[model samples]
Target: MDLSALKQLGMDDREINLYLALFQLGPSSIRDIASHTGINRGTTYESLKQMAARGLISYAPKGKRRVFRAEDPDKLLLLAEEKKSALEGTIDSLKTNIIPGLHHLKPDFSAGNVRFYEGDDGIETVLKDILATVGQQTDKEYCVFSTKSIRHHLYRPFPNYTLQRIRRKIKVRVIAVGDGGEDAEYSERKWLKTDGPVDASYIAIYPPKVAMISMASENYPVATVLEAPEVARSQQVVFDALWGFL
Candidate 1:
């Protein structure tokens, strides 16, 4: 009854309409189908031809005219299964063909590479990707700037990740706006607080990547990630200098 699912099976709107029409009307001529479904004769005939070839419908001649009927409804399940199997086989072939070639593909920033993520999911993805780039450091230091009221938002993501960094003896360096130095109390991570308008346009340096997040001002709260070594190194040097002087 839900014909929408058939869309994934590559059935177009006209095909779905015709199939549903046939299911409801039983065996019928193209003219009858066209009249019943409010489709024109030419499109109805063309759609029926493809449906017959896909084994979704059948046509039988009654004298000089042909009547079209829906195939067994159970075959819909079979068609779905066939589509799944085909996709799985294609995926396996693609994996065998593509992944090995991926090793040769290097990040080329000169060719221009950047991602824009919007909404909460986009923000979360930027955070997760930054975390993944952290290497085996003697200390995992993070310099973050956030808009007002920092709570577990700062503390929770670090423990499990910090455990990995800490196994390598990596410590964290956090510098947030006023009173944020206290929020990271749950972990061994150190914090330094400064006074600023912690509302929007906060920049973060998490090694190899610099992320800037501006949350829903006049413009949408989208994230931009730049993955160039020169940019990252400059940010790193600036952060280290700020951490030392502040």
Candidate 2:
């Protein structure tokens, strides 16, 4: 198993090592912990102090010495919960405050950062970015102009992508250029009139990013993500206008 996940809960390498040392040794002194982990005394003492501040480790009096020990390992779950709560707050702030203020700044034409992805992995990357972004918003929906070319390539590599989207409560409004997307929960589709199948391109217009996938090439599937607030807003406006007509 990856021990690096402990870093996500805000513990550094030395801190994690110190905690493990204390846990294994069962209420060790700072000196014992330093000795066990091979970390120096000064560094170990500082780490224990920081960990105690975070409630990851605690101390008690044992005779004339102070004993330090790890809290229940399950306390890591509290870190996860705190992280989730903090992320939700940040997302809410972006949606409500930060993003709206961004419009007043002059549009940087150079801000359109285009990223290209190759093969099935590229398609997966684009889809996951869309899912993560749309999942954060209160609106929780994005607009897609999908075609057979993109669908045929993506469904194989990311068959569970749709189920994952639903689990995240991310919704999509799609304009199927061909035929046959029936009603599904958290999704709405409309068929748009097109001649000769619209050349097999898929467009997903989400806030601050617009993703396009193509399967027209013989060798591999390809995708591009364009991140520009103004560009995405323009695409969204067009999608909304067309959606109204449909």
Question: Best-fitting candidate, measured by lDDT?
Answer: 2
In candidate 1, stretches whose alpha carbon ends up further than 4 angstroms from where it belongs are 89-107, 114-177, 181-189, 195-201, 205-208, 214-223, 229-246
Candidate 2 per-residue C-alpha lDDT over 132-220 given as tens digits, one digit per residue, 9 for 90 to 100:
88988999999999875556666567788889988988888999888755566789998887677567788889978988887748548
lDDT per residue for candidate 1 within 1-246, as digits (tens), equals 567989998899889998999989999999899999999999899999998999999999998999999999899899899999999998987778776566347655644456777765676677666555554343455566554443334323333544554554434456554553433322332344645545545566776678887756443466788767678789878777766776
Q: Which sections of candidate 2 miss by over 4 Å?
A: 1-112
Q: In candidate 1, where is summed lDDT lowest over 10 consecutive residues?
A: 181-190
In the order shown, the candidates' Cα RMSDs to the true structure are: 7.1, 5.7
TM-score against truth, every candidate: 0.62, 0.59
The deviation in Å at residue 155 for candidate 2 is: 3.3
User: Candidate 1: how many backbone clashes?
Assistant: 7
Query: For candidate 2, what is the TM-score?
Result: 0.59
